[model samples]
Target: MRLIISGGGTGGHIYPAVTIAREVARLSGNCEILFVGTKHGLESDIVPKEGFAFATIEVRGLERRLSWQNIRTLCNTAGSVWNSIKIIKRFKPDVVIGTGGYVCGPVLLAASLLKVPTMIQEQNVIPGITNKILARFVDKIAVGYKEAEQYFTRYKPDQLIFTGNPIRPEVMSAGRDEGQRALGLDPNKLTLLVVGGSRGARSINNAMFEVYKHFSGSPHIQILHVTGQNEYNSIVSNIKQAGIDISSGGNIIIEPYLYNMPLALAAADLGIFRAGAVGLAELTARGIPSILIPYPYAAENHQEFNARALERHGAATVIADKELTGSKLIATIESLVENPAILSTMAEKSRESGRPQAAEVIARLALCLIKLQSNNKR
Candidate 1:
């Protein structure tokens, strides 16, 4: 079996496509999978390292503001469609699947034009430009949230499926006891896990630093903050200047990033982070209660929508980006940490939103598309 999986710009899009590819290969032996991503995207570095063969086309997202760069980007994007057509012609796969990013726009357009069976997986509550355009021609659409369905009402209902977002297997395999041991965290003290998205959120880092002084002397609760690699140095330098010792703090452990986040999430009593689709999915799957601060600048303010999906379910609390201050954040954290009953209740509600089998469902749909396409040829 052969398939082309396209979609990638950030880790949010790249990781899910990689997870789906791995699952597809595991279930169907001898499957040939190829990834299509942009030359400027992280996929160039990420895909090859995973040992998957992939091709890169030059593509750029549209500029929100009026500028000459917008014109250049528009021309480049048009060129990308032609480039994608060449890739489609050479690979000639049985099916094409896109995970929803700007890169998907050109490739899925090429797939649709060629009359190949195509599928798209949307990870956010609000549809992105790529998914919105490809919805017309794709044979199937898998979504993480049921709320996303209305966005594609123009399409036939049969085209959309809510399969949830596929998470890394390592995330599912982690256990609470193992999590605590790996991080040398105490089993008794209330532990809060703070992570920005993969690249890190500067707003979240700033808020944490502002309130960290209050926790300096507290022995009742501990903090594990992942500053994200890009912002790590500045965050660390600022903390050191504030006279807050990080190395042996009795109640705090701050680092740039956690390579084993699944373990950290498993061990956490509370989580504070941005509400990207994967971050929310992992939190829900592990039943980790969180204070979600959606990225203020996301296209269509979709992060807020993603957070509300959990907040309405009683799984999380939402703090608007503009309203997140040290005092407000600390107040929210103390309220949850001081009350184990409330935390437990929230954890249960978080689990209620988790869809652990989302990857399996998407894989099944991919195979179904392949089979349907093959039988049509017969």
Candidate 2:
């Protein structure tokens, strides 16, 4: 099988696209894959590293209100579609998939217009404008959140599938003990993993100083805080100024970034995060309950919607970014870690909400789309 997968901008979109491509290649045996994204998007950096043939097109997102920029973007989109069509014709993919991004807008539209089997993955509870517009054109939608169905008002029921979000297989395969050893954690104590996506959040970092002070010498719990690369030096400096040890003997372990994140997820009993769909998927797959502070400036405030879904399902707690403070974070952490019954309940709910097999499900659906489309043409 020959396939083309397109998704871009953020890791949330790019990771799922990568996972699906990998899964499809594994299942199909003799498969060839091409990844289409914008040179400016994160996918350009990521897709090539995954060992797939990568191609780029020019595309930009449209602004919501009437503006000269929106007019220019509409024209650019037309050019992107033409470029996507040329790529599609050259690659001659049997199936085309989009995991979610503005880049997918052009690629999927080109594939559909050419009568190729095509699908898009929507990863947020509140669908982004790009995915919403492409819903009518794409052959199918693999949604990460079931609640997202309400927002995608135009599609036929059969076209929508609740496949959850695709995650790296390593996230599921890593074990707690293995993770503990890898990250140098105490297996006897409850572990709290605090992260603000890959880039780190300034607000979250600022709010964490008191958490460090509060739990400095706790025997029952340990905090593993991934501080993100840019903010690490400042945070460590601040922590040291506050008289906390930055050495290995301390209860709090601070990291700039985690290369072995699957192992970290395996070791974590709880998490503090920024509600990106992919990150939440990995956390839930491991049954780690969390405290989420959604990014206020996200395109549609969709991170809050993502966080609230987990909260409603009893898997997490939501803290607005504006309201986040060191005291509030510490109290929230204490509330869960202090109550084993509540934490255990939340963990169970998180596990129940997880879809570890989502990658396979989406892969199967993509292959089925090809078969169905082929038979239709015959």
Candidate 3:
């Protein structure tokens, strides 16, 4: 089968698109895939590296309120739709799938206009504006959270499915011992993994000072903090000024990012993370109990919605961005690590809630869509 997948902008959208594409390819054994995304989005850089044929459309997001910029963007979107039409015609895909991003808007619209089978995957409890609008046109809507169904008001009930979020195969396959050895972590100590996102979280970075200060040189646990690339320098300088020892062989490992995050997640006993849907999916896939600090300014405050859902599942605890502080963080960490029972219970719940096979399920659903379309054509 020939498939076209579009999703871009941030890692949250891009990663899911990539994972879904990989899953689909794995299942079909003989499939050709094309990825459509904006040149400016991270997909341009990441898609090629992932060994997928990548294409781009020039489109920008609209402002919340009416403005000259929004008008310009809308005009550009029309041209993008035409551009997408050309790409879709040349690719002649059996199915088109969108994972959710502004870049998916034109590609999915063009596919729908062409009457090709189309589906979208919504990854948050609060549906993104792009996905919400595309729901009316797409053939199916695969949601990460069941709570998101109520928000997509325009879609037919039969069109929606809850398949959970797709996680990379590596995330499920990585081993704890291999991860520890690869990252130079000690197997005997409890490993705490802290990450904000690809771009990093300033609040989490700032709040971690106390965590480092408190846990420095502790024999029981080791901290691996991924300070977003932009914030790494300042955070490291601050650590030096604070006289905290993060030396070559110290118990703490501070870095800008981890390309091998599946390994990191495998080695992690606990996690502190921003409440991006993809990040939360990985944490749960690994069954690592976590404290989620939702990004305050996310569209529709969806990060908080995502975090609260996990909290309800007893898989994670929510610490609002505004309420997060070094002292507060230290206390939460202490509370969990000190009480083995609570952490273990959270881990079990987290493991229970994980849909490790979500990618495969969604891939099969897409294949079914393709088959149905072929039947209707016959």
Candidate 4:
């Protein structure tokens, strides 16, 4: 199987594409996978490291407001489409899969125009602008949330599938004891994992300071906080200035970033983080109940919708970014931690909401589509 998987801009989009590509390669022993993304996207850095052939096209997302810059964007998009056409002609992929990002626009459209099979995976309840536009053109639409189907009402039922977000396999396979040992935490204590995506969240970090203070003396609970690299120094300084010694705070472990996230997620009894679709999927897959704070500035405010979906399923709780405060956050954390029965129930519900095999499902679908196309040609 020859495949072109295009998606980028953020981990939310890039990781899913990478996971799907990996699965496709595993299923089809001789699969050739090429990743197309913009030069500036996170994929440019990540894809090559993952050992996939990577290509870049010059493309920029259109600004929402009317501006002169949009004229330049229009010109670039046209050029990108032409570039995509050339790439598609040369690669001759059996299928092109797009996980949501602006980069997907030109590449998938070019594939559709060239009469190649194409599919897109949307990672949020509310679709992004690129995926929404591509929905009419693509052969199949895979969504992370079931509620997302309502947005693509124009597409026939068979065109859409609720496969959930593709999560890293390590997250599913890591055991709680393994995770606890890796992170150097006691297996018997209630462990709380706090993370705010790859780049830390200022609001979440600030709220966590108070939560940290509240649990400073507790011996029954342990906290693992991943303050994004950029925010690490400032957060540490602020803690010191507040007269709190984080290093000596017996049960707390703080780091700028977590390299072993599978371990962190596996070890966590509860999680506090932003509700990007991928993160939510991992939490549910691990059966870890979370307190989600959706990033307010995300495209289409989709993070909030993602959080609400989990909340609706009784798997997690939502605290709007605007209303998140140290007091409120600490209170919510206390409520969940203090009640073991409720926490266990929420964990079970979270596990129920997970789709651990989403990557394999999408990979099989793409390969099946390729097989069908080959038969049609005969």
Candidate 5:
């Protein structure tokens, strides 16, 4: 089997595509896979690292407002459609899958026009513009949240499968004792895990600074803050300037980034982070209660919608990015830390929302689609 998978621009899109690729490779032995993504997305670095052949096209997202750059973007995007068609003709994939991003638009459109079997994965409660537009042509639609089903109500039932988002296997394997030892965290004190996605949230990093500054003398709580790769140095330097010693604090551990995120999630008692689909999925998968501050500028304000889904289930609490402050954050952390019983309750609820079999379900659906498409072709 030859498969072409297109998606990227964020970890939310990339990781799910990677997970499906792994599943395809494992189950569809000897299948040749190619990834199509933008030259600029994290996929350029990540796809090849996973040992998959990757090709890039210059695709830019459309601006919502009137601007000169938007006009240029529209032209480039049109050019990208031609570029995608060329790639599709050259690759001649048996199946084309899009995990949902602007990059998916051109590739999936070209594939559908070419009569190639195509699929898409939607990771938000409110589907992004790319996925929403491609739904009419997508042979199979795998959705992360059930709330998405209503949006695609116009589609045939068989085409819209409620397969939850694909998650990393490491998440399913994280263990409490192993995670604690890996982070050198004290087993007794509460460990608050702070993450702001892979790119890091400037607001979140600033909140952490306030956290360390206000609670430096408190030995009861330990913090493991991931400042993102871009913000790490500045955050560290600021700490130094404040005469705060991170290494000697004995209660705080700050990292630029974490490749071993499952371990970090497992070790954490409570989480403070953005509520991107991937982040929320991992938190729920690990049954870690979180204080989610959604990215205000996320497309369609979808991150808040995702966070509220978990919040409604009693799995997490939402603090809008605009309202999130150091004092409010610190108070929230302290309140949770003081009440282990409530934390336990929230943890249980979080676990309830986690569909551990999400990836496996998505993998099975992809296989079924491939088989159905193959049979139809024959």
Candidate 6:
């Protein structure tokens, strides 16, 4: 089998594409897979590291408003379509899959035009502009949240599939004890994990400083904060200036990044982070309740929609980014932690909402499509 998968820009898109690629390889060792993404996207770094064949196309997202940049983007998009056609013709993939990003626009569209089977995965309740446009052309559409269905009304019901967002396999296999030992965190204490995506959010880090200060000397609860590389030095300096010795604060662990995120997620009793679709998927899969602060700048305010989906399921609590503060965050954290019953119920609800086998399901669908196409050819 041969497959072409494309998604990029943010980790949310990149990780899902990688997960699906991994599943495809696992299910069919003989399969040949290629990933197409923009040269500047995170995929350029992540895909090759994961050992997938990688290709690049020159593409740029359309600016939201009229500008000289928009003019250049238009020209680049046309060139991207031609480039995508060339890639598809040479690779002759049986199926092309797009996990959602600006890079998906040209690649998937070119596949559709070439009469090859194409699939797209939408990772948010509110569909991204790229996926929304491609929905009309693709053969199948997979969505992380059920609410995403209404946005793609142009497609037939059968064309839309609710295969929850794909999660890394390691995240499901890692155990709490294993995670605790990996992070050097206390096994007996309640663990709180704070993350603001991979790049880090300034507002979240700032609010977290207050939460850290309040929990500084607590022996019953431990905090693992991933400050993101960009904010780590400044956050550490501020902690020192405030007279708090983070290094000696036995209950707190601060790091610029958590390279072992599977361990961190496994160890966490509670999560405080942005409501990116991918992050939400992991939290639900782990049955860890979270306080979601949606990135207010996300296109179409989709993060809020993703957060509300979990909140509605009783798996998470939503705090608008604008409303987040140290006191408010700390209060919410205390409320959930202090109440074992509420925490347990939230955890159960999260598990109920999780789809750990989403990658497997999507992989099967892609394989099915490839099989059908090959059979038709024969």
Ranking by lDDT: 4, 3, 6, 2, 1, 5
- Model 4 accuracy (lDDT, Cα): 0.93
Residue 276 displacement (Å), model 5: 1.2
Give me the runs in candidate 5 sitting further than 4 Å from their true place: 66-79, 217-219, 245-248
Whole-model lDDT per candidate: 0.88, 0.91, 0.92, 0.93, 0.88, 0.92
Q: TM-score each candidate.
A: 0.95, 0.98, 0.96, 0.98, 0.93, 0.97
Candidate number of the best lDDT: 4
lDDT string for model 6 (265-372, tens) is 999999998999999999999999989999999999999999998999999999998998899998999899999999999999999889899999999888888788
Taking the tens digit of each residue's C-alpha lDDT, what string does model 3 give over 86-119? 9999999999999988999999999999999999
What's the lDDT for residue 22 in model 2?
Answer: 94
TM-score for candidate 6, residues paired by index = 0.97
Model 2 agreement with the true structure over 11-107: per-residue lDDT tens digits: 9899999999999999999899999998998889888988999999999988879999999999899999999999999999999999888999999
Off by over 4 Å in 3: none
Q: How many clashing residue pairs are found in candidate 6?
A: 0
Question: Would you list the rank order by TM-score, best first?
Answer: 4, 2, 6, 3, 1, 5
Expressed as tens digits, the lDDT of each residue in 1-378 for candidate 5 is 888999999878998999888887777787889999988899999899989999999988877788999899878887888898999999888889999889999999888988888999999999998999999987999998888899999999889988777788888898888989988988888888999977789999987878997766467788889989999999988888988766666788889999888998988889998988988888888899999999999999999999998999999988999998999998888787788898899999999888777777876776777788779879
- Candidate 1 lowest-lDDT run of ten: 243-252
**RMSD in Å for candidate 3, one decimal?**
1.5
Clashes, model 3: 0
As a TM-score, model 2 comes out at 0.98
List model 1 lDDT by residue over 173-285, tens digit each.
99989999999888988888989876788988998876678886577778898888899899888888888775665778877778888899889888998989988888888
